[model samples]
Target: MLLTIIYIIAITAEAMTGALSAGRRSMDWFGVILIACVTALGGGSVRDVLLGHYPLGWVKHPEYLVLTCCAALFTILIANWMRHLRSIFLLLDALGLIGFTIIGCQIAIQMGHGFVVSAVAGIMTGVSGGILRDILCNDVPLVFRRELYASISFVSVICYWLCIHFGLTLEWTVVTTLVFGFSLRVIAIYFGLEMPKFIYQDDDEQSASSKDI
Candidate 1:
């Protein structure tokens, strides 16, 4: 029940963000709806396909797709006020990331997968939608460039696995992971923290490496 609620909230929030991205590009209403649906449902679809899980979530529950489309239209209506709600949207996006991660991890565990596969599932579910959204928008994917986003997803999976391994109740584990991952993401955003970039200047070493390749 809790997971269902979180999933709904997460997808709605993701859809809104996707709509906003489309708006930034001056896309039409249809484009907004398309991007919103992809941003809300793409991650789960990718995870299910990779796991060979039959009957994808949106496919099985078409209402979720309806919800995302509604969310997209709602965002368009409120586009004027969105600038003032940036912080709120960021927090909601963080919540969605952790929620998606937990849902994916739980599903994989239920399928009797080991820790590594579950972790991958969690990370994919957490980040892939935003990746698709950014790609469609022609922007760099935030998961790759944002401060501690995907890393937090992975860490949340580890925390969730540990909680379950140590006999935490499912409810408590979800609550704990949500708090931990959400807090980490909020802090990362506030601090503008980011993973170190490896900048390889084109020089003799790079030229030689390219030639070898």
Candidate 2:
């Protein structure tokens, strides 16, 4: 039930963002719907496959299709609110990331996976759908950028595993993990936290200058 709520919220948020992007690009309705669908189902599909869940979530419950269509309709109507959409994009993405990660980790643990694999599954669940959306929408995936976003999911999953190891209730563990993941992501965005990059320097600048003289 919790997973269903998370799926609906995440899909709706993704639909809104996707609709804005598609509208900005002047895509047709077909393109908009395609992006919205991909954004909504891509991550969960991959996670389910990894966890050996056949037919997947949306397939087993066709109500998810109805929900996705509703989300698409909402996005189309509210497409004019593009600026406000951008303003809330980061926050929405963070919420989706935290929720999906927590849900994925919980599912994996329930299936008897160890902490390490559960964390990996959580990371995959958090980022893969966004990657699919970006690919379909012709943009770089946010996870592949230098940002600390995906790493935040990893850290959150680890914390969740620790809580479970200590025998915390599933509900409390999920709640705590969601809070930790969302907070970390919000902090990273606020402070512009990022991974390091390669730097290069001239090794023979002095010798080259003397020879030029």
Write down the TM-score of every candidate: 0.94, 0.85
Candidate 1 positional error at 78, Å:
0.7
The sequence of per-residue lDDT tens digits that candidate 2 reaches over residues 17-103 is 666667777888888777777777777789999889688878988787667667777788876775666748778778888888887
Candidate closest to the true structure, highest TM-score: 1
lDDT by residue for model 1 over 1-213, one digit each (tens)?
A: 888998999999999999999999999999999999999999999999999998999999999999999999999999999999999889989999999999999889999999999999999999999999999999888677668899999999999999988999999999999999999999999999998877766687578678665
CA RMSD of each candidate after superposition? 1.9, 5.7
TM-score of 1: 0.94
Deviating ranges (above 4 Å) for candidate 1: 204-212
- As for candidate 1, its clashing pairs are none
Residue 80: error of model 2 in Å?
A: 1.5
Indicate the TM-score of model 2: 0.85
Tell how far residue 113 is off in model 1, in angstroms: 1.0
| Backbone clash tally (model 2) | 0
Off by over 4 Å in 2: 1-3, 198-213
